[model samples]
Target: MRDNGAIAVFGATGQQGGAVVDALLARRARVRALVRTPESDRAQALAARGVELAAVRIDDPASTVAALEAVDAFYFMTPEADNLEEVEEEVRVGAALVDAAAAARVPHVVFNSVFGADRFTGVPHHDSKHRIEEHLKKSGLRATMVRPAAFMENFATVMAPSLEDGTIVVRMPLPDDVPLKMVSIKDIGRVAAALLLGTADVPGGAVEVVGDEPTGPRIAAAFGAHAGLPSRYEALPLSVLRNDLDEAMFRQFAESSESPADLAAVKAVEPDVLDLAGWIRSTGWTAPADRARS
Candidate 1:
């Protein structure tokens, strides 16, 4: 934001981080992307875009400090992993990154958190980030927290497979009248960049990002309209998602997917936020012809 020096970005190879890196580059900001493998294709691609790739392990304090050297600011987001050990690694690495940033005396830090991380939602993932936010607040670093709602990308990863049979099965019955808060990953990047660049009114304040709140039928209608298939929604109880998601997350989906973000404020920051239908049409998502093959 200050345009003083280069900014270091963690997880630059992943979705959220990549979007931030791209946005920063668009603003002509000097960016250094932290990654484990500098030779990886994604990392190399970032390097090709004029980003300085710093090959460093986040858990190692010394490596992290080196990565932050001469960095004027930082952008951080915790990485999610699959198993218990990997999950512990995420916390460890995230804490180490925070400590390293503090020790380096970086002037500004923008932290990516979940929309409902302000308090305990009984969801482990959501609550875990709240803890991280607390640590960041006390780390003596000037930080801005950017909390984003449920990602629209989940349509492809979590729901599209079920659509192969021309029927999408939802774990929780999302009534047509109910609303669910959803945001595009690109919009998340835009908001974060705005905060870091000091373009928004509340630069250091907590900002919740959400694009739209649509019901199950509305979502199915959007997908069906684009895919040209007779797709329908079949909502079950929250119990069906237990095996795949944490129990806490299941409760949120079954009860309320509507986020507590201020839509007007978020829209003010990123005016062109995409809605469900626009996002679906842009991705060219289609119905699968055969469920077995899909």
Candidate 2:
């Protein structure tokens, strides 16, 4: 462990938190993962990696504060809420965590927020995180917002392509040529780790992190090239999601080409940051043929 002290991270078993822990480990920082279920398999997995696990419940400030005691820094991110009701719950949970960090007197906090969260884009989930950002700001604790753009990993999940008639088709509720700002989950962790470790200089104590801006066709081509298959892009209607919150979010996505995250600026901090093609290759993302078989 480095002499700076242990860094405590909330949501440590999840994707964002897991990535943060990995980055901190790579930098030789001692990591304390605050989890609700210390007995969970995920928690055990982290513990196996030498991560110190502390049980915490967001509703119990005492538990959270105890988990944060003596940590050099705290890093956290809220779970996504798909409805207005869940959004309010997210705000409540986020505020509680922020309050706990303050009570513990952690010197610095790094919040993994979403890009455009500060803009009040009318997306319930994004706005919910912005509310947490507000709570963090008012808590009077030194804090930094490492706002990551859309996850490049989403292409492997929500935006994964479909195979039909021997061709791979990528679909989104977006125009084919409209670029979507993206950052790898790993990069998000790297940026947050830098802030928590005081290794990165971010103007205004916040940065919108993005590594690539790729349109649907470009996304399809990358997958196609990897698999040696033909590819195409399909623009789907927002109504297909059947969720008002998602529809509203996608509507804002239509304007994502104008995101504040500068690729050059992000790369300046994380030189090994991957673009779409690089992510595909590094992740070993294959075409739909392999996906379907899996």
- The candidate maximizing TM-score is 2
Please give, for residues 109-215, the per-residue lDDT of candidate 1 as tens digits. 88898877777776666666777888889898988888887889988787563555556433334555666788889888888877777677453468877888777
Compose the digit string of candidate 2's lDDT tens values, residues 173-218.
8888788888899999998888888888677878888888888899
- In order, what lDDT does every prediction score? 0.76, 0.87
lDDT of 2: 0.87
Q: RMSD to native for every prediction?
A: 2.8, 2.2
Q: List the residue pairs that clash in candidate 1.
A: none
Off by over 4 Å in 1: 1-4, 82-87, 161-177, 201-204, 228-230, 242-245, 254-260, 290-294
Candidate 2 ranges beyond 4 A from true positions: 1-3, 290-294
